[model samples]
Target: MHPRHLTVNRSRSSSTSAGSASSCGFCPQIVQGRAPLGQAVGRWSDRHRPGAVPEEGNPREHQTPSRLRSQRARPRATAGRCEQRRAPGAAEPEPDRRALRRTAARPPAEPPRRRGRRRPAGAAQLAPATHRAGAAQIPCRGARRGHRRVRHRHHGHSSGPRAYFCQNDHVTSSKTSIPRVAIYARQSVEEDQGIRQQLDDGRKHAADHGWTVVHEFSDNDTSGSKERGPKTDWARMLSAFDEDEFDTLIVTETSRLTRSLTDVLDVTPPRRAMRVIVIRQGIDTLVADFQLKLLVLVAENEVKLKAQRAARYAADRRKVGHPTSGKTPHGYRWVPAGQRDERGTRYVVDEAEAEDVRQIFREFLAGATLGQIARDLTSTGRLTRKGARWHSSTVRRVLMNPLYAALLPPAQPTGQHSMAAIDLEACTPGAWQPIVTRDDIVAARSRLVGVKPMHAGTARRWLLAGIALCGVCRKPVKSSRPVNHPTPRKDGSVAPAQRYHGYRCHFSRNGDVIDEFVSELCIQRLSQPDAVDLLTPPDDEFDLPALHTRRDALQAERKNVFALIGSDPSRLAAAQDRLEELEEQLREVDAVIAKAAERHPLADLMGVEDVRAWWESRTLARQRAIVQLLMTVVIKPVGMGHRPRRPQDVLASLEITPLI
Candidate 1:
């Protein structure tokens, strides 16, 4: 604590002076001066100094400063003492001329001899304004710590400026002339290498430099590489620095300050002079060759390189149908290496959650809306894997994921396209077994997104535009208006300018009439007793005898390649990759031979009593799937003049062949 102002009365008594001095020992004896105290009671700096002014007649200014007798020992500090004597080489106080007016020569008390560096002879005898104001207004050279404000007053003296003194027990040299320091430590994530260790090191370094630790700031699990994320502590440290709270900063490393070049400039602000010590990097911001900007660039490059390596590793894992290191998917939990099954996959199915996943797929494929399914699941006692309420987006995303169907999304040179572009017929199998099959997921996903985009970017309007092929070119045809140019209708209104084409076999027909004819055929077929047989798979891929022969040839070939690579590292590496691919193909063939019939589509159509109304509700994509599954529409060529005049003509030009 520093003071207000100190004053002394103009009385001339030794007892009164000694009694007032006993309050605090900084100024050993109080002044009993005869001069009236001026309005400025405390003013001592390089401009104005405290010195003796002799009376008009007596020449007491010539008195020699007192020296301690050799017999007297220097005083020692006590338990509760706050005696702060001035430093070594400071000007001794002139004996009060008023005291000398009566007694010719009374020697003053000797100040304690403190051991410390002396002020140079050229140094100003007045206050330096370095340490805070001490006794009176003369600055003390004692340590500026462990201080408390104290006041000492003499009785019977009422008219003088009141003085406050900053009292501390131990008065040594200006030992507390140390710089104020603030430590800033940060770690981007929670880990063993944390801010605690950095702060410990910063405190130790500050102690070694004789700096007073003023502020300790830390940010844990908060990134410093980018000017993103919350760094409230870092901002506060800078604010305090700018406010002149402390002039020095300490850190465990250069990168801890910042990894971004733009943010690095803020650490060593050019406008304000400051000292920043990077402990581990051995770089000081005050040094001429600090190059903080260059260090930031290096740190930034290292961060980017590390990120790229992680992404490349994850991409490689995904290429082989393994998870790319993230939250466990809803159906499974990650198992450790040795505890996993022989195939070395990390996750095992968690049945309680898997049952929920299966339910979502079943209800969604059974023509349940996303919102209805989400509400029903949310009403149950069970919770999602993340312990969250089910939502329409959550259900839709689950349906879009290929993982449940035991297939990996196809990897493009960049990222793969959206789910609508996925080839459900040629899906790549994953290491895990299926919870929902390919047909079920594809059907459910199609209902959510509707029909895939048209090849020519036209909006989908007809039920079987893409599904029904051009019989001659084997190309899918789109709906087109009968007239290329706008023509007047029966009501004298011109037809719309935009036109579309429909499925053809070198001959065109009314698209609306063709759609109606196909819908009627589908309804009549589902009305038959043999509709269930329509779910059976084609026999082309069920030829087990040929598949077995191919499998034998592939195995023999792989064995010969294996024998040639024995004991050679480079060749063995190649052979392993080759064998793995062959094994994958073999597994596929085995799966195809045992593949079950897809009955989900028929299951959806099973219980609906009103067949026409149910058919009307289906999307064009699902309707097309059903029609392609049940039959093929073949259209044959007819001459140009073969334009249909009657509804019976379209029947003559069309062919509906049922494969089952």
Candidate 2:
């Protein structure tokens, strides 16, 4: 087939003379005289011929050159037709009608390469072949034609065409950064072995996951069952979490962290972004769906079960006439149950301590107050079971406990006990050896009841009502006065009036006289320029080196005990006993250190130039505190028929003992 040509006309006008028709590429001259117009004219002429004119002599003759070119461009009725060429710059000839028809009938080219794969040979062609005319090569119009092949290839596959999509850009392999982890370990009992094991397990888990262990937070002897109180290290670890110090937390198990569901939910829900890994439970909170909630519930149930079991064991032990709990009473010490069928231990009277208990009861029954008994015990260098100086409250507790009486009180009434009374007849002899007889106990109780004044009330206005002690009787001075008194009038007639009030020692000086004397003494002493130095003594120097050494030694001993705990079960009791002793000694050392570290508030007050103004500006409670810190005022009994007339005389009758 011959190449098809499309002639583009340079001239704007379509009309041309016979001479121009011979030169125009698009307007071809008819070789023979125009045949009949009907016979020469074909399909191409009917579709593309712009204008036609019939000749004057014949109907086949045409006057316009465009109509003549249109006739020559038609597809030949027979195959024997010759091809013609035209010169450049002539009127553009009509695109070869025969070439257009042949091009439309030819098949299109194949689709573009997809996903780096070659198209199959059997695939239907979709793109058009290229066509060229003169120097310019025209791309095939079939390529632009509406074909379903390209559209089907794009939308048919669910994965889409991989070649069109860059996997490196659109589809990514996730890069997971190693998470920083914090390991937390806790034990409810004072055993370092449990803590050590927890920490070891947690670290191993972290190592397996290739997580960076940033911190290890541990709490010893800290209970997880209760949500109250401070969990020192646990609190600190949470704070660290808030600061984004770690992305993951590793624990030996959930129970070590918290046994309360509320605490678990409260702590974990807000930190959903952080991962929690439990080594034993094989749970990761980050990926956990419902498992985390289930684990928390399990831990809470375990705590409840443990508590129930403990309560049952305690009740059973109490039924068997054994101490139901671990705490030893003040006069006794714990002993292993030697042939007793009780679960663990029994209480035996500590004889040396029991003697002290007997002395306390004897003194109380002999009319000594709780405070006086405490002072007496303290004077003899006796300490309580906790190894601290005795307090009046402590003495009172010992006196009140029914175990020390010949009989014990009925079991604490369940629900409510409105009718329960002190059953003196229920006294069981040899139930426990009594420290004091029933008569002595009754006498002491009767004296306590009798001493309770019918008009017992607080003294709000009296400055030293509760604090002032009678120097002679060694009892609290009561604020009192006569209800009525006679006031002398100018007419020499006496009228009733309220009497002046004062602090009274039951057997000695009047309350008014003593109050005035003490107040004036306190004001005068504090008004001195050197009063501050005299009132607040320098704190005693503490030997920190010795304290630190002692603390280190105790810590070393604790470690040694912890080491022996696993090897010797018999040694456990001894280790615990020694640890308690060491703990008390450590407390004493800590107290000394704390005292040295404290700065007295009086030190700040000392810098004031006007001491009286400073004292007056303070609250009454503060003023009383200052007075108590400085000295103790003792008012001596007045001599018979000797009344004081001067401040000096009054001062001489009183004793001021400086404390600082």
Candidate 3:
């Protein structure tokens, strides 16, 4: 009988099945089906008897009928199924009543046993209340008395909750309902690639996954199978990710994420801090699966292997001098590799523009500056790629460039082509023709110093301007009013006349603007004579070498006097006094000699008459120039009535001019 059915029968006739031994007598229905509960109880009585069913017969004959009936009656809804067996043939009568007394002895309850599979990594935790202590196994949903849901084991060990926050609370209180996601997509080659399709598919996946895309970073014309290069943007993306701008990063495929295991492992440092999900690789940040990790690494290794093979093929081509394809510089045009076929379409250079380049270089080498060449081009109406006038700097640069002097030969080998090719010296000729000779380029560079004016000029100043000052503000005065004025007309008609301007003090202008001004002649008188004298040196008389000789003679004489003092004691005091007098005379001579040496180097040009004559013949402008060149003019404002009377007193002692 099924364990569930037997268990059910135990519950029925609970009272009658518990006491009467005959009612509990085991039969086929009661033994294999839902046996009577009392019969099951009585079988236990014989089973424990000292001389009851012997151990020699089939152990089944000693079967405890009571136990079998009890197992069948148990509720299999919670308890496990009960096994049924045929009654033993020739079975001894139920052991004497004394055996019944011995079988009845048994423990009431036992401790509970552990249930369910030990590991949860491959299985799930069954809800508690599915079993009873050491007695029954139940399959039900709701909690039963003293039962608690337990965590399942993972890898032969129990797993504990990583964090305690409520999921609903975390989501509800978040600043945005949108979950941040970033999509990274790339292609495997620089040519007509599938990156566009990948991006489209990625967007579709994001929509299905309900991901709110914060950014879509793409690397186009780049190989997804190449390991991270100088131009890779993943590092910058990771920096942004660390700022918590995205909750997940989605790549179109595993290869797009990385082409090497090294790059794949780089994802972990970022993942340890927050959730990282690589949808294509089936990786979730919360779970660690070694098998899946190894699979991703394997895929990346395959991509790297392919890249290595391609690199080797390219290297072999370079060894054989095959010109790798890439962008050509501005001076040359790109043409396909083929001669004119039956179609009669030939790839050729624009010869006219090439000739123009040659003409530019020839002109520059013939002592024509870059500016001259540019002007020549403009006169002939030549335009650059932008359709603008040729600038001198551009012309100069072209003159210096090697490619224009002579094009590189065709069929030259280049390294794996990249942006580096643009700046490389590798170029081919015949594909394009040279416009200028090498000698012409060298000559042009030697003469070039960027177009500049030939004659450098010096600054000329307004005379007397720097020294003259505002009487009130003390700021330097400037040439103020026009001097030469219109002549007053005798016939009542005023004729226009040339007027000359001169410097004046502020007191003569803002405070009181005056028309009649002092003569420049007066300023010259105060400045010129004294300035010439101040710059002149005193006359030199004694020569420096002669003075030194005379000093040596004086010192010898002093030593002789001291010797005399030693030779004759009586005349010692008198000799010493005489020695002192001679020494004072020598010191005076030295002073005169030093002064003459210092002053003699300057040539004196302060001839008073010459200065006066020069001052008198010059115009006001010339007079002011001479005055400023000679001395500083501090205009001491005098009251109209209190002006200086004496020619000498009217002159202010002029200060020296400061060195520039």
Candidate 4:
């Protein structure tokens, strides 16, 4: 029979023959001589086990007949007692009677035999024994009782089964619980306080608390003042908190977490249920009250006070002619003044950078725009004192600084602090060498102010603007509104409508006719093989080397004037006069060079094969530039009461002045 199908038979007959032995229906049939002593005892102990009953009743009396049979089947093995067995296939009556007589001779008050270790109450004990063919051992009340005892031992524990059988039939214990923890550490500055120190402290605290460190979150060189943006590890920690990845949070200090009280109130309130331990301050947000609030307030106030003190010191130093900030101007270097003066540091000219400063001023005064100067400086791979690329704004700052003119402007304090007022015209001689004279600066400013600003709304969209001139009036032709003709409708009503867009001459001629003629004539002239040589002038036309040498000398003298003006303020007026004279001389040289250099033609500059592509790639502004560079186009009047209606007539009326 299958072990699962085996059942203990509780019922029994009222009477049985005198030499017959009673047994449980589910019990395995034991072979007489092969049954071991331990196996026999174990089987008997399971069958005759007492049932639980009320304290007022006898459990034995309430047992059924099956219980009586179980009791009779048990062997009365006493101390120093033994049992006899009959030989196989032999007459067993005499031998069985002898064994019965021996068992019956034992006193009823005799104690049972003591074996190895005693079995636990109602626990089933199995022993190695030989079994007959087709026999299976079925567990009885002992198995059920053992399971009940195990459940009672671990009544409150929920982590799987507490008792499990090993290969040797022994029970083992398993871990009940482990707490997960998250370590968070931050440092505002890496040099001020290392992130490693914070992490090490936090990890040690977690170890003391016996928490399993599941994750480490750190924000290095990040400010705790700001509450938003790119606090990468902090954001990840918050997400992990929401997911309940850890039960506790460990930090080196509360300030390392956040300096902002608002951030604390915002982030901590929701996470109040979680355990937060700050090792340095001994502050646990889980049990925190007004103390955390007070600590955050103190930290914030410290940051504010430090900022205020720094600003005040900077303003005072600036007032006394000392360089307050670390950054010096491009043309100057910071140097420590003698210990006798209260002002600690003063600026001295850096010659290489000072030359660049002078060159910038000279270029601006010599007709180069701010953007052109910036581009030229950048093309030469030069950088500012801060190791940054040259920008128009940087160049403008150099020109506008009063220090470059040997003047000390009063300090302008920023933020909430108000600074004392001082004279705007206060000149500080020998404070630092100037890079440019006041008059050269004034002349450059005058030139900038004198230039007329173009109207944004009047931007040119035509191919020719200043290039085309009216032959009769000798003035430039301009693009006009679209030419309109009257259109007759089916209802016999005439409407004024636009027919084509064209340009207008100062006198009388269609703009389209003149524009087409000029474009075709320029293209045909440019396509010629001799066009290249006709456009280029000989190199011997002007003395380029001599002019360059003179220009360099004038630049050097200008720089020298700037250096001297700081020592003697009286020389400022004379320096200004000399600057204006130097500027006039530079302009004269430039005009001569400009005339001599006007040799290369537009066609030669733009390669032959690339001409069409280059023309197509140009914007309208570039096209207008090309037109002006090549030649001057003029429109001749057709005379009074006469109008040119065809392209051929318009071509004859147009005049071309080639520069080459």
What is the lDDT of every predicted structure here? 0.60, 0.57, 0.49, 0.57
Query: Total clashes, candidate 4?
Result: 1
lDDT tens digits, residue span 1-660, model 1? 111111121111223322233322112333222222232223112112446444353222232212112212222212012212333354544544554453335356655563445646864342222233342221222212233333333333333433324433222222334667899988877664678888899999987877789999988776777564334798888779777698778888878888877676665534334567788878775443256667878999998899799779867776666764446778888877678676758667889989878777765554445665666677665578768897767777788787788887655443345666665434556777678776566556545555432221222456666667776887776656555566699999986776555555466755776778878888888877777565454667467577667766877887788789977878887688888988788656545543322235555776567778888865454566578768888665666655554558867867778866
Which stretches of candidate 1 lie above 4 Å from their native place?
Answer: 1-258, 266-295, 311-316, 338-342, 410-429, 449-660
- Residue 418 local lDDT, model 2: 24
In candidate 2, what are the lDDT values of residues 590-612, reduced to their tens digit?
55654443334354466677766
TM-score of each: 0.36, 0.38, 0.37, 0.35
Any idea what lDDT model 1 has?
A: 0.60
TM-score, ranked from best to worst: 2, 3, 1, 4
Worst 10 residues of 3 by lDDT: 136-145
Model 4, position 2, has a per-residue lDDT of: 18
Shift of residue 344 alpha carbon in model 2, Å: 9.8
Provide the lowest-lDDT 10-residue window in model 2: 165-174
On TM-score, the leading prediction is 2
Off by over 4 Å in 4: 1-251, 254-258, 270-277, 307-312, 329-331, 334-342, 369-371, 385-388, 391-660
